[model samples]
Target: MMITMMKSYRGKLHLPMLAGVVCALAFLVLLYNERISFLSSTSFMRFNTCAARRAARDATDGGRAKIDDMEEEDKLEYDADICDITEGRWVYNRSIKPLYSDRSCPYLDRQVSCVKNGRPDSDYRYWQWQPDECSLPRFDPNRALRKLKGKRMLFVGDSLQRGQWQSFVCLVESIIPKDQKSMKRGRVHSVFRAKEYNATIEFYWAPFLVESNSDIRIVGDPRKRILKVDSIAKHAKNWLGVDFLLFNTYVWWMSGLKINSLWGSFANGEEGYEELDAPVAYRLGLKTWANWVDSTIDPNKTRVFFTTMSPTHMRPVEWNNKDGIKCSNETRPVKKRGHWGSGSDKRIMKVVGEVIGKMKVPITLLNVTQLSEYRVDAHTKVYTETGGKLLTDEQKADPLHHADCIHWCLPGVPDTWNQIFLAHL
Candidate 1:
């Protein structure tokens, strides 16, 4: 059976390879200069272009080029480049990391474009994606979302949770027949309804998915009391009977201070959270979240997904770039480094995996962290403005510290995130 399956797969590869070869030949003809040359100088441009398209396809399909065919050093070099963060390696699979490329996404066609100079730093703008315009082969969002209609999809976490929610929304909304779509915002939940699919996508902001001091209760004197973790049940109970529950909570816990007065404890006095360490706090929080999941969320009725931490590009030295410089103006999709593991902080990953390990429910993990760790350039601060009209000039200037270059550009990275979501769903 394995032999037969392998042959069947090999047979499948034949067509794409032949098609790629034909496309490569046509480009060679176009670059003939004066005439088609069989024995003349080489056309490096055509050669590289064909290689790029093929390489992108291979990587996107999760096929690392065969190493046995090349010399040891060359094989190693290719492996390194294909996974390079600076190269924006995720472009091969842009559905998960939308800002991986400045060029329009092949899946969505020209609907996604770079706003500022198509560099890495320019990665943070909206993609203007159109479902109808997308040319890439993909599982239909209408079909996937159809399964979720009338079902509540909740994103629970901190500000970064908003990023994934926005991404998931834009992706689903694009597929929804526009005439049938509607959105309604409430104090705790923001719902997007697609009449055509009968689906209601909602976002409920719970920085901590569990009940923590941050969500409820006041500490210190009333005059000086700062708002912190209050009540998780106030929000968590409302998300019951949900069809999809996407959870995230890292950046906010690490935010150290209040992210915004609205999402945090500003009024509560400075009896700050004693759980200062991110890992310990995360473990405890997940314990609470797990207790809730096991107690309330029914696995048969709801699909639960936990988004791994979204890495920030604030550190340039990690990517071999100079200090004070952010991920901006990077056109080429190649990383200077080879390994994704080298760039990420593994301690966090271990804690996350450990928490999930204890869960009785199967949690789908959107593990874009290591791969995203390298994409320090794909942020939107000081670039475009649509969703975030309230932030000031100063906020945009200090994106590394202020404006959220940490999140993701809507319609770009999030679209891919939705794609992954659909695949799992």
Candidate 2:
């Protein structure tokens, strides 16, 4: 009966399967005969057969040992020669989609929730950010929360940065129980605490990253924007000891109005205030910020990131639209490769690159500007609500009046920014 069973098994096995069985038995035999080297004298066919058999055995044995070996090999291979992940252009990938949904993420704020606020299209949510050389690992919020446990991640910048903060909060907040998370808001700062993980994700309003007239507890007007180019101590104090610090300052600098810099206190009036060129003023402000980071931050304990300027989709000419349509009603991204929209200023990006290059404490530049330039269809536009009411008909009619082409929608482009952020982390 046993012989009949063996013959039945042999008859059922294919040539490849027979080879694998022979290889498995040969491997066992060679285990005792250490002098016989299977790799040196064995033919290619025999070696591949043995490899296939070993793979099958490993798979059946749960593959933990084989996986550990491969992981160790990968560590050895990639530990010393990591590539620059952010220096890549965006590509269209149908297989990849947004990591979170606006409907599913309860932590999503109203202003940036473009889907829930009555936007009719879903195409914007399907676009993915693809790096040039390597693959960006999909965001796993549970893993992100695990890494963020007992740590603090802070985003400091203008409203664009605030939008990114909201996106990130929504991205990871779904994994935590409702009762374990809490939120607190202040004039310049808002904190989201995950009590279960002892983690806090916070946003600090520092449009210029320095003490400015616009730094008031409540900044209502962008027209009256003023920056203190030489002082950042007031805002920099709150940034110390953070595990991750993301800083951005751009749109406020590009308002085309000369910035006012104060050599004296605001209490002293405009006596020490001087008008400076925008880019020059921007350079000075960044220098002040860089100085503070260099002096205060410990490179070993903290990771610093400065996001590239977030593009605005205000001009139709920028996206080759001859009919003069803004980001209000667009439903698709720029289909061309290397589409350099007119919204981003290369001069400003140059300033950022130069300043960050000179920093002693390795600050990563999340160069998301080029990737964002194509996403003209992803802005909040007129579908957004202001003060708990939708835009009026007149407001919707005037593109320049109620259309917000500056800030992005939640579960949109900023999620890609955070996804890249997670891969690097």
Candidate 3:
């Protein structure tokens, strides 16, 4: 009986199953070895790579510092200290007194009297985004700039929104070395974090910041729609626990009207267009945003800011005696209007201001639109990278829109935008 059982076990009947089990075991072992190798190799590679990059940057910086008569040496030290403060170290500067004289209004710009119907007084002496200073308020950068390190600041909006984000990054990075600065692109947001400042600033590309056609998805049937608010929520979570939240969304509504996307129910269960217009959509969106702010965001440690709609450059006819052209060759500052004057875009501004002002949460308004509209020539459409080179004919054929008509050239309008942001901080 034992000899017969041994013969059966060794038969072809069980050979395939036994071979399969052996192969499965081998695969798992191979997978484990590969994972271990990858983990160990990457760890070693990163350690050596970082050391090499640091050594290279230091050697190059030493020569540049010597050539510049060592001016950057002192600047570097001050910057490092400021960067350290971002890690929550409060550096008190005795020489810098309270930015405001009036206890009623803690901002110095608020005290100064300015022309009626103009930009805020706070913006004039500092950023000068608007002409008059009546409504302008300022933030003392000296007080708040270094206070944020390891904190997150987010700006949510369209292309014009990028101007503010870029400006903020440039200003902070200027104080810190480029080597210490790092940028990582996220699915919905792009993040720039400075190790020195221990600060993370991110911008989410939510032009509408509401449930719109841009965000919704249509299945096999175009008519069948789903509101994927969770898509926005994914990035919204990053806004959580953030020390400073700067939110702005407007330029995407440049169609002179907002697109209403119907998902399940319409207002009062009624469907169709005559019911909702651009302003209605905008108001509704802001209401949703405010609700999110009220629920998810905590105000005690988090400072919330909403930058007003930035002005769009549509016609060259009104820009300082120009005609029939866009902002192609514009370089000089607006000699005709200072700040956002009478000619500034009002239709969008009114809606934004009204919606934001009515919110239960107090959101700081960085009124940059009026002042920014004047710097049309500062845009970088007609040219190439950093506006260093002009656009070729081949580039014009693409549907990417004229580079000049949209995004502002870096180091130009954005620099002042940061100055404005810093002033407010």
Candidate whose TM-score is highest: 2
Q: Which of the two candidates, 1 or 2, achieves a greater lDDT against the reference?
A: 2
Model 2, 179-277: lDDT tens per residue?
Answer: 999989777899999999999999999988988877755455644656678888888889987999999999988886577766646755545577877
Those runs of model 3 whose alpha carbons end farther than 4 Å from true positions after fitting are: 1-145, 177-179, 213-235, 256-258, 263-275, 320-324, 338-344, 384-391, 394-403
The alpha-carbon lDDT assigned to residue 11 of candidate 3 equals: 39
lDDT of 1: 0.50
Question: Mind giving the per-residue lDDT tens digits that candidate 1 earns over 1-425?
Answer: 00000112543564434545555565545546322211111111113333444454456447875322222222111111111112223333333343333333222212123353222443333322111101222436566676776677788766566666655555556555558787776555677777866677777777666544444332223233222333355667887878888888776555542221223443455444443355555566567677778778888888788877776665455555565455543322224434443324456668777667667776766665644555444555445443434345665565454433565544455554555456446
Can you give the lDDT of residue 72 in candidate 3?
22
lDDT of 2: 0.72
Comparing 1 and 2 by TM-score, which wins?
Answer: 2
Query: Which parts of model 2 have CA positions greater than 4 angstroms off?
Result: 1-99, 217-223, 387-389
Candidate ranking under lDDT, highest first, comes to 2, 1, 3
The segments of candidate 1 whose C-alpha lies over 4 angstroms from its true place after superposition are: 1-88, 92-139, 175-179, 212-231, 257-275, 328-344, 384-403
The alpha-carbon lDDT assigned to residue 417 of candidate 1 equals 51
Model 3 lDDT at residue 259:
45
| 299: Cα error in model 2, Å | 0.8
RMSD of 1: 14.2
CA shift of 289, model 2, Å: 0.2
Per lDDT, the best of the predicted structures is 2
